[model samples]
Target: EPQGKIDTGAEYEAPRNEIEQKLVQIWEDVLDIDNIGINDDFFSLGGDSIKSIQVISRAKAKGYYFEVKDIFNNSNIKALSKCIKKNALTISQDEVVGEVELTPIQKWFFERNFEEKQHWNQSVMLFSKDGFEKEAFEKAFEAIIIHHDALRMVYKNENGEIHQINRGTSEKLYDLNVYEGLSEKEITEKCDEIQGSINLEEGPLVKLSLFKTHKGDHLLIAIHHLVIDGVSWRILFEDLSKAYEMAKDGEDIILQDKTTSFKEWAVEQKKYADSYNMRKQLEYWSYIDKFDVRKLPKDKEVAVARIKDLRSVGFNLTKEETEKLLKHVNKAYNTEIEDVLLTALGLTISKWTGEKNILVNLESHGREEIVKNVDITRTIGWFTSQYPIVLSSSNEELGMMIKNTKDSLRRIPNKGIGYGIIKYLSKDKMEFKLKPEICFNYLGQF
Candidate 1:
């Protein structure tokens, strides 16, 4: 659907050298596509931020090393292979087990001091026709806890001051709770129960529950939000599947080589927060802070809103419409899906509220290449950044709106990473004046 110079009907060129051949194989395995040519583009073949991390990790396992940016800059195998280095990056073999500094997101969480901190988590539900083996699942999770340093994180409250530490992996990491003959309703309740059982102070912030139902087995995994984000889930699930299969087959459970650790990223982030570059963005954020945000009219006002009080209305676009939105329409304006979606949202909000200026709280993956020589493509942690952006819906024309929204997003510094740094980690913290009621996030294709 996307217009490009590469001819799909023509004969494709195969990998020429060992590096290119290895890269092609890795890309095929990660993307789950067959016969990826050296000239093929990564994004055209369904490559995204998450899949790029997978490719990087798989390549590193094979003794090849390259940054995530290299993949973006050199999308094709031939060009990427040239940038790949034979010498591996200096990743410490020892487990990162010690006191770890809280990142900007973690600091933001602590600042909130939610009512039930332990119950705040990110979770997933997986179902399989054939039930999983408890032994294999435990072994797989144990391997994961040891490899991903952040999974073993624990918090300690010392005289009103909170600190985090990565506990040693020798202790029991996971316990498989197996329930027999649970109905769908009971399984849902059990998931909620497990979600509330995560202990932040002690250790093992991750919980796993297995429910055996009439149809199939259900697996529920709940991890504290302090250590995991959307991108981290992809890395976790991929490693879990691979490790579980190896354990089931009675083979040694060996995952891919570790990338930069979460601890390293946190340290680098602290340094960057105090750097001159981060300080320069203060004026921009201050300008954004001055935007006048109007509160949306609510049907019923309540003192407090909780999960139980929330309601959602679902909508779906037809398959043909989705195709145009994702691919075909982008060609006309040279825009991304976010630009178009945000334009529509801004226009709708402007019509509803009768306001031209629309303020939105935007969330980004937050794994920007801000620090030099620090690669977190495969690292797992709560690397999400929240920042505010004001979209002007003064122009009603669709084309002009798309162009304006795209330009507005382009003006953000490092995908809004510096906002969190300046707010939570800076020496002189200033409370922001404008708080956007609406939040928007676009999770790219999984």
Candidate 2:
């Protein structure tokens, strides 16, 4: 074991081992940043707690299961690797439920009336043994298809009935290649070639492209986030890794997947009424929006829905300055950094709207929290939710106002209304129509 073990509970430090390099690669890929040190703390290095769940959840893909506490305990890459055991996640069976019908969320997507396309524009991550055995990788993939329902989903009809994601048998792998040292432009071309493999309206719901680099003793693997959501991806990684590990050992892989399929969930959700909570939310929203802002923000005025311009702005504070700011904020109010950010935006809206109390529709992801103990790593569906947050602010002390606004927002049910389904559900109903014209998203994944 690499001897740099610190109480991940105490100080931050780097892990010293070959394993850290893999951790660094995974973190860099997931965080989309580079130059991470072995001792660098994920959150301290700019990873939020929400993203932490995603990172640790995916530990399975790499042949390990990182308890949320593990990352915190081994805050640095070196420490994390010291604790990881080879064949840790090796299992005998798949780690997912039986393939079911389209989930309630998937059904909601088909009703959105968006242009239907056959190919699912999703990202995927695949891993194999360090030795780069092409023959074994092929066999592993074949086993995945045989054991799991790879291309099965359900869509909802106008009549509120559900149907399979596509009406056909899933296709088998016709080709597989793992390349390295390709230029960015070359990688783009490779992506185009991989896109040809997806059949959104037919066999497959998403595309999978593999890119591998021979790093002497190990391999660098990167997965995309298209066909599967964060949760499902982790399940896929863990199960896939276990499968490959078992194959290497000449043992039958065991999975901890779900007993029923996503399809089963969809067909069952319909027996429940969508009105209970959703309708109550609508009533609360309608009641709150009676008094509108002086003028809607510029974002809502456009007749067409285009992506809001995403401008990333960063700033730094000196150690002393940081301490002082945190102290003052803490003294004035009890809140977190997230609350502060929301408050500032709310106040900014107030400045523009002249409306002291403003409601902004915020988008949140709802990937987990379903089927407790069930591994949903590869089950992709529209797992996001939206909620109305009323930011009450004043001309003075905008920061304080923001902090308070967020505190109030923390109380609402968090299952955010992701656009994929929310858009379709409220398509024709004015009641389900959005309340606030202005919106904000702190997409942890993006």
Candidate 3:
């Protein structure tokens, strides 16, 4: 079998047909590229799941209805053009669906909202060498909020059930906090003071504060975790940088194409829950539920205190050792680093608790290949999929344990996304709750 060839510098022809021309334009707009060729591959040009959703959303706006699967299946502009279902439906580029159902992760957050609200916030502080362009940066920032619908969501409770409503744009701007001539301690205190003050119920989840100091400008952006995740931040930063540069140069604020709205995803998820594959996976989970696992040690059986004080502890191996474990050792055992890590965890926990079998909750990115043409590459929201996995440390040999862990994970249908689908969206309304005490997640690389 012959694999595809790589020719980065190869020249390609322009789009021929009218459909191809329009598709090329969409590709250029979504990928932030200029003059995209008809033959250019979508994935090769930085089209991810989120971006794929944007492409389809933009296409729908242009009266060319298509799904994410079409983009994946077609791959190129010419092929995608032929695949799109031409329609006369006209939807505004800025108009998004209102009153959407809460995603699984969002529901999880709401269930635990009795505790500290500020802990559910995701924030970053950026120190740019040169001062930011006041007008340009403001416009760029506004464009970002307008482009992503999730950034404009506010949660509301209807009949005791919480739902997210998409409110268009906000009049909020990046207010500058003057910390000039102030001591370092004062600046630190001011930042902390502002960080602790954010209303979760506010429509606009994203807020910015600029600190003008003697050295340089420090831009602090804080967004609620319900609207943005780790991957969403990367897309936001990239778009911000590009938008800022364009606006500074007196160019039009043209962001990449819009992805599928989060509201649409919620509707699709409901439909997918009733699917045959999802039903089959639910059966598998039911079968696995029969086995009982040991729980971790805790002070109180029925805890009454809210989890207020939380902290993170990080550990990293040497670069060489990390690479050897991730690449060489994984390849030799025909397994992944996650499997090895999980097996090691099982061994370590068994030693501590004296339990051969244990159940732990594993968090997945939740962007599985379920709906054929739906893409969420650029769609930002809490899309975490959490499921329970039973790990056994009964095996004495390390190799056998690793193999067992890998096999166990491989048995999960659609990366455990089906669990969330069935639990939240299924019409059966069966109460299936499996809460594992310990949670494990591996973020590959940021």
Candidate 4:
């Protein structure tokens, strides 16, 4: 960890107050660690962006409210607790049900107009050794759909413009299927069928299939990409696990109070796009668009690369190496994991392609604090931002290259969120188009 941050295996101090004790408890639960100290660093304990949101959500459920940024600013329990306060704004308790505006990311998705858009989805297959009760699982899933309003979202093309609406609780939430004694190939085929079954125009964007086998049960969940993202999956998984346990135990399932709804966030994003601050970012984005970076030479070119054309090679680092990379190395450079990884990537590209100016399409989680008093830390929806960045790898020295790359990334305003705002939501029509061949997204440790 850092200079004075408490190590997980070392002696540590305890929480000093009730708030600190509560925060410690939440941290322990969310981080899946035992006896987390008041001064322990969250990231050091495998706490990431997703876990941070879980902490905030669970804390909110306990009537302690704070912004997501507060966690980053004050990572430890004692420090973070000092920043916590009673929620000032009156958050709506009623179910969020109405027409929802498309976020910049959603607008970007529609602009692509991809073929077979309905098949564009995110899915997960979870296994339970003990298996699940059908009725209990249904109840849990129903509660999840009702709690997370975005899962009920449906789209329609009206006058060539796509419109999104949040269906009421009375509507069907998900499609569920049960299978018994299915072979592996059969299970794979069933998953494929369900994956392709997601409908965007009609209702029911979420699908579930439970397979019963001699060993265990496999549950497959497929959700339309428009309604969910990486962060949303974490929230969904946690809620499903909790709600299922409660239902299995024959207890009333009561989930945490919803954070700012996705609908509210959509509206707030539109307003922020038109704000003076958003307009100020036009120059920065324009500069990025104008940056001249030659594309890397490819071994062979294809007219169009489909999913089948893609190939991936995986590698692993030793546990000791991973420890140094995640904890120790950052202390020397005063940087994050992304900075070091990008620095290495930029250097390698420069050496191989003889290109000092490297262009990259960067992706961020997009839950930035752009608008004041707007929080979507616990809200479930697709909130990913994609924008172009140019990394200057002119420096030959290792130290200089790392510093330069770190600076280049840090220079991005609001994690490059404004680029999408200006491109999709701004009134002024500017022809700002730049596409990089390579996209870099560092999804932190799961």
How would you encode candidate 4's per-residue C-alpha lDDT over 77-144 as one tens digit per residue? 87898898995556786888878988888988888887778999999998989998999999999999
Ranking, TM-score, top scorer first: 4, 1, 3, 2
lDDT score of residue 54 within candidate 3: 60
Better of 3 and 4 by lDDT: 4
lDDT of 1 at 372: 74
Writing each residue's lDDT as its tens digit, candidate 3 over 1-446 gives 11232222225767788788888888777667676677766655545445665676567656687766677678777778888786433323665747888777776677775656654678898897787767787888878887887787877766877768887655442333444566668767877777666655554566677777668788778787888886677678768999999999999888766666778788788888888888778778886677676568866576564445556677979977754564356545656567878998889898889898888899877766687656576677777888889898995688888889989998988779887777777887446556688888875543
The lDDT-based order of candidates, best leading, equals 4, 1, 3, 2
Instruction: Provide TM-scores for the models.
Output: 0.90, 0.58, 0.76, 0.93
Separate clash counts for every candidate: 0, 50, 13, 0
State the C-alpha lDDT per candidate: 0.83, 0.51, 0.72, 0.84
- The residue-by-residue lDDT of candidate 2 on 1-446, one tens digit each, is 23433122334334355567668777777666556667665654545545556665456566655554466567667667767755443223433333345433454454444442333345543344454565655556556544544334323243645445432334442245566777657766777667555444234343344555553212222222223454455455656677777777787766544333444434433332254545455554555446555447564454554334556678877967654443334334544445666777876777766778777777654543333234333343444455566777876665556556755765554344423233344433443443566677664444
Candidate number that wins on lDDT, 2 or 4: 4
lDDT of model 4 at residue 219? 94
Off by over 4 Å in 3: 1-92, 170-182, 299-308
Which scores better on TM-score, 3 or 4? 4
Candidate topping TM-score? 4
Of the two candidates 1 and 3, the one with more favorable TM-score, higher being better, is 1
User: Candidate 2 lDDT (Cα, whole model)?
Assistant: 0.51
True lDDT of residue 343, candidate 3: 92
TM-score of 3: 0.76
